[model samples]
Target: MGIRHIDVRLCNGCNICVEDCPLDVLRLDEATKKAYIAYLRDCQSCFLCQSECPQDAIRCVAVHERRMPKAW
Candidate 1:
């Protein structure tokens, strides 16, 4: 229900998603140079990776289903 998909075919390997993930959930594959969900369980579902992805290759569950942290 967290990160649902990563379309490697459409990914440009820009590393935006990897760098923007606050939880370090995504990683850049050294071989394919594509981003992958390295720690799906650690994902907070904040949608940061999806929004920052230039290629729009990342897809996560709807915002309503996310457990976003309360901003203090």
Candidate 2:
């Protein structure tokens, strides 16, 4: 399960979410120029990425909820 789901359509490749991640669980993809989950298990569930994202492209689901099949 991923820590956060980045909406590629809403993301502008600004890298704000990556910069705000305390655990460095998010990073920007050079090829896609979009944010992606780099280390989902390392996430601290702080919601910093979602809060800092200007485009609101990040969605961090609760750890308990991650076990469920989500539709994104």
Please report the candidate that would top TM-score against the real structure: 1
What does candidate 2's lDDT look like per residue over 1-72, in tens digits? 335588999999998888877778888899989998878877778887887889988887767423555699
RMSD values for the candidates in order, in angstroms, are: 4.2, 6.4
Residues 1-72 of candidate 1 have per-residue lDDT tens digits of 368799999999999988888888889999999989888878878888888887888889854444657888
Clashing pairs in 1: none
- What is the RMSD of candidate 1? 4.2
Highest lDDT, which number? 1
lDDT accuracy of residue 19 in candidate 2: 83
The TM-score values for the models, in the order shown, are 0.81, 0.79
Flag clash pairs in model 2. none
